[model samples]
Target: MDEAAVKEFIGTEISRSTVVVERSAIAFFASAVLDDDPVYTNADEASARGFEAIPAPPTFPFVMQNWGAFAELQAEGGQGAGLGMVLGPLMANGGLILHGEQAFVYHQPVLAGQTLTGVGVIKDAYVKESKGTTMTFVVAETTWSDASGAPVVTTTFNIIHRK
Candidate 1:
């Protein structure tokens, strides 16, 4: 892995996506994740729990890019330039990329019927040697905000490339 080449992407914006949180999608995700919480499925229960609408699961923001309205945006190339634009060139010679870790910071509750805009940026990049293999780690952060531009969730994840 070319550490210097990968480092060039640090502090760069890699992806921007718009996701419309739907109630049906939230119900499906909650079911798939084995979360049988009524608040995730019943709007009345959610409201009684002090939420304005159905509340998404804690880690729901991570999958927002794969489902919801983001799916349509992805087809139309609305996912900005994508992560491939940053990692593709660095791995042209062939290397393995792996997901390392992920975390989320919630500033406010994410309801099922809100639209969010996510902006991703490369936070940092570095290289390390383990068992004689060179590994390059890249840290990326994405902040999802509501229509009024208030942050709902900020997700940080790590991607590792090895050759």
Candidate 2:
């Protein structure tokens, strides 16, 4: 689809997937963050501290939410203006900034053994011209909830498609 067609598809509900939080995944996340916090690493310490299981870091939800949503979109053959395209045009015209703004709200901390189902939708889209290049901005919002129906987190990411 062309840019306009893609924009028209904005606000369309896209995909949903369920992810089970495993102990190994949690440990991997902890290692990635270099977080020495006992709450995320020491299971015994976490339980002693009254946590049922290791509490995932705040940003950990992105691993399952953002990347998962992107994978879903790509699987559906959605066109994406990649980073290379953004940089190539910018380099030709001195430079340009493609800033991505993300905001999230956490209703509950993710814990191991819990299953989170993520639902995502395209929220908005528009285009702007700067320095002789057109930039299409798409905003998508995703909500994740645990199997018990408790809200886990919500995220919104702004993607810039440059031309």
Candidate 3:
């Protein structure tokens, strides 16, 4: 299908997946990213420092949740318009004002060995004209919570599909 055809289909709710947080995964994330924060690395240090356990960095959940959602969306026959299609208008366009703006409220710090479930949904979609072409923006919002039903985090993303 063409870009406009896909853009028209943008408003559909895409997919959702749940992720269980694991200590090993957290450790690997911290180490791979070269983050030496004790709250993410050393459990003893975290406990000694008065945390429940090693807590993940604020943006760490994105690593675990967003990519999976994107993969699922693509696998379900979504096309990549471009980097802007995957990211947003700023990155796709040549504007110097591109910024990553995500608002997340953590009800509880993610602790080591805790399995957090992430529930994702494609929240909204719309088309906007840019220059001489049309761009479709899809917003996906995902909420993560512990098994006990306590909220963990929520991420709303804008994916722009250009035609």
Candidate 4:
């Protein structure tokens, strides 16, 4: 798609996935990132530090958002979908995908075993036309909320596609 077509998707809903935040997911993420914070995987340590449960690390929601991508991939019968899968359509042409920036805002602590739903939307899409090449900047945000519908986290992802 060209710039106009890409911009038309600015307000489109990309994906939504809900998962019951659990110990395994949190532990795995912490280990994979080499985060030594005990609060992310040990309930006892968290409680000792004044937390009611094993609290998710600050960047947990960002990783948790991948559930939506994986779900979409499964629906399409793809072999597998992990991180970075949400941008499948945009990257179909082998364009250079750069993770530009990321920001996070947390309204409340996300604890283990809490059912949370996250929805991703195309917040902004703009194209930078340069000589002989086109670059697109896509900013997507995912709002994660608890079962009661109260937003607990908001994450902004800035992705750049160069073709």
Candidate 5:
């Protein structure tokens, strides 16, 4: 991909999605992630643990976009263009698009039965040369907020394009 294209993608809104946090989905996610915690499956257990409801496993928000909200957005006439829009150029160039890193900053515990809206932006993009290979790193940040419009969590992930 050219520098001009990369520059254009940086700081752009790549994705917007809204997800409903279902109790069943949280339980399923916990099982999938190998977290067999009682609080994730039983509301009573979660209540004893001082939670109002069953809490989603950590990293659950990462799937909120691709698994549900993105599909909904797509059905709404491609409103949620998502990360694909940001990585399309790099991917079209016949190179590898790889996940580099992911991080989450939680302002509140995400519990079941709440709705979250997320907006992701290409925060930064740059290129590095290593061992004669060109590597482009893109940083994307998404902020998830509750229905009341308060921030719930902020997630930052890096995608690397290598040629």
Candidate 6:
């Protein structure tokens, strides 16, 4: 995936002000991931455990920042293009897209019902030649914050588009 267009995405803020975090979203994500953590599903359990409400499990922020409003973000008037948009041009150029890596760091627990905002940027885009193959790597970082502007979680996504 050596298209110049894909390279232009480096440093681009692909997603901004993504969506708010809610209790239902947390519970659903927890269920989908088979977390089965009471803090993510039961408000009473979370409260008894010293949380104001059901607290999201780790990695919940990524769910809200990525798939939460992905449909809207990929369309016109949203970010330049969502993940799929970037993947298309890459795949068309004899490249294969793969999930390279992912990491998350939590500064604070994301509370249920708190309206949150997210921002993401294509941190880097580069090509590497190894094993007689040329591989393109795109790394993105998205941070979710609370209404008070305190960051809750920072997630880094690494994608490999290989040819």
- Rank candidates, TM-score, best first: 5, 1, 6, 4, 2, 3
Which scores better on lDDT, 1 or 4? 1
Native-referenced Cα lDDT, model 4: 0.76
lDDT of 2 by residue, 34-57 (tens): 887777878898799888888887
Model 4 lDDT tens row, 1-163: 6778778878777766776677778888888888988777677899999877788878888876553334432323342232244456668887888989999999999888677877778899888988977788889888888889999999899988888
What would the TM-score be for candidate 2 when compared with the true structure? Answer: 0.74
Clashing pairs in 1: none
**Higher-lDDT candidate among 1 and 3?**
1
Write the number of the candidate with greater lDDT, choosing between 3 and 5. 5
TM-score of 4: 0.81
Q: Candidate 3 — which pairs collide?
A: none
lDDT of each: 0.86, 0.68, 0.60, 0.76, 0.83, 0.77
Give the per-residue Cα lDDT of candidate 3 at 30.
Answer: 84
Worst 10 residues of 3 by lDDT: 73-82
TM-score of each: 0.90, 0.74, 0.66, 0.81, 0.90, 0.82
Off by over 4 Å in 2: 1-4, 65-99
In order of lDDT, best first, we have 1, 5, 6, 4, 2, 3
lDDT of 4 at 39: 78
Clash totals, every prediction: 0, 0, 0, 1, 0, 0
Candidate 4 wrongly placed segments (more than 4 Å): 66-92
TM-score: the better of candidates 2 and 6? 6
**Considering summed lDDT, which 10 consecutive residues are worst modelled in model 6?**
66-75
User: Which stretches in model 6 have alpha-carbon errors above 4 Å?
Assistant: 1-8, 66-80
